[model samples]
Target: MGNILCDGSPIESDPRYRFQGRQWETSMMDAPCNNCKGCFLAMFCPCCFAYHLRVLALEGRMENYSCCQGYLCPTCTSKCIPGQDSCPEFCLCLEVTLCENFAISSTRFYIQDQRQIMTDPCDNRIIRFNNCVQILSFVCHILAIFFRELRHLAHLLDLFADLVYCMVQACMQAQTHHELTLHPTAVDYGQAPRTITQQPTASDKAPLMGHQAPPAYSE
Candidate 1:
């Protein structure tokens, strides 16, 4: 009939409700304010939670909210980390001193000079980057030259191929003309021979035993 937890325990029946190391000694029915809800149930108002945390932060009372074992804003958090001690993680200002008001490091610490420390390794990233830039520059130069020369080379190649094709065509045409001509110009100019020949006359033939034949006809 009441609000139940995961283990089937009722909120009304649960005994221990601890907060801020203080125990809720009384029953829920007895303490009307036990479940007042929202910000009233919280340590401070939502807005005040932030404000108080900030105040604490400046005061340097907090190490962090986890040490408080609960959630607190940046203000109350700083308050929990006691002043004079350094918390490099949250210390915004690189100060040997502390203040709850400032957010960033306004103070300075003794940082060792790089010259005093060991020399740094040569960064290949910088070398590789420089080399890449140089390579790109060289490529760009080559492309520029290639673009200018490509058109001229193409034109020359086209002209050369055209010349070769024309020469080959001329040679082929000359050979064909020599082999297949109907008339041989300038060489065979004379007339062609006649088709028919004349026959000889009968009077022109002579007899072998001749003289006798003419006398018999007269008788």
Candidate 2:
């Protein structure tokens, strides 16, 4: 019992160092410089700064991180997407729009993406056309017939009225039919639309398209 107490004091201890048990020597390293809000916090790794920023972006706290909100360069300001450093100031991201439901009668706008929306009412033009068509159709059909039966034939007044009414009815049908043919979903494929130009001949020597030749060859 006496010998056991005297010699047992000599004991070994384990090291607290992380690299002590490892086969390879571990190197102590410094992080990269993270220019966050000009605080100049140098990071332990360049990879880590990006990781942190991405995490911040995903968490919807990009504004909280000064480094993320700060624009790195002009290119970043121009090209960055939403939730990114140098993102667009105000952005709109709409995947689709069915024009049939669009409405702009109210000043209020529905904001789904980063930007406010602009609406325009659909089918209103159809309503207007229907209203106009009803009035014109009634007058042209009824009044033209009445005029033919009541008015004298030698004067040819009734015939003229009938012709004019027929023209009006034909025009209404044609215009409405043309409007009905318009489909918003149909993509034009970038073809230059036909525009009527009251273009004078080259011999006429017009001044220009928009500018009027200020009363030339006049007193």
Candidate 3:
């Protein structure tokens, strides 16, 4: 007789076998302590707490995460190109533009990473660069009026921003390094490639000597 369990097994087949699979690990941090020494530190120094929070909730190494984003912000050093005529102002403008792109793109990357790990769908959507700054600024001012400790919330946000800024810079540097490694040009090499100047041969020099007068007869 053909077996009837073509796809998934019937629910009534077994009760003990279903519970044996490996458990999935969570990527979220636990709630901070309330009354202990840790809580005191967290309350007094929320920036440090946020750093710890980020380090904990993440699944893999922080370097890996930053490296992934770093490749996106490749560096363009036109000024360093060999023999290429590049104006000072143009290079300066490009550098400034690259910096701006790095900041904006890096912030976006951080926000996206945060969204993936966040537990609340609504909160994830609400937490963004512009929204975070504006909302937190307003909230900080209002809360500071009531709770004295809340004044530090602004500082916490600043610290977090600073951290992201540094991370973005790191990503940019890493990507630039990677790009340079991949394409080492003549300029990047110790010196620009030497041009082969054509040496004058006997035939070429004979023409020039043809017009010259004979050696002086004064012997």
Tens-place lDDT digits, model 1, residues 1-219: 112111222123111111112211222122223323312322223222223333333233344322122111435645655542454334333221233111111000000010011111121122223233334434444454547654444444444443432332222222212211222221232333221132212111111000000111111
Model 2: per-residue Cα lDDT over 1-219, one tens digit each: 334222212112201111111110111111011212211211222223223322322243433322222222324533443433343212211100111011110000111000111111112222233334334444444454456553233224334533433332222222222221231111321332232223211122101001011111111
Superposed by TM-score, candidate 2 places the C-alpha of residue 202 at a distance from the truth, in angstroms, of 52
Candidate 2 at residue 41, lDDT? Answer: 17
Candidate 1 residue spans exceeding 4 A from truth: 1-148, 182-219
lDDT of 2: 0.23
lDDT score of residue 182 within candidate 1: 23
What lDDT does each candidate get? 0.25, 0.23, 0.30
Quote the positional error of residue 53 for candidate 1 in Å: 99
What is the Cα-based TM-score of model 3?
A: 0.25
**Which candidate number maximizes lDDT?**
3
For each candidate in turn, the TM-score is: 0.17, 0.17, 0.25
Residue 155 lDDT in candidate 2 = 28
Judge candidate 1 at residue 205 and give its lDDT.
Answer: 15
- Give me the candidate number with maximum TM-score: 3
**Model 2 residue 209 CA deviation in Å:** 37
lDDT of 3: 0.30
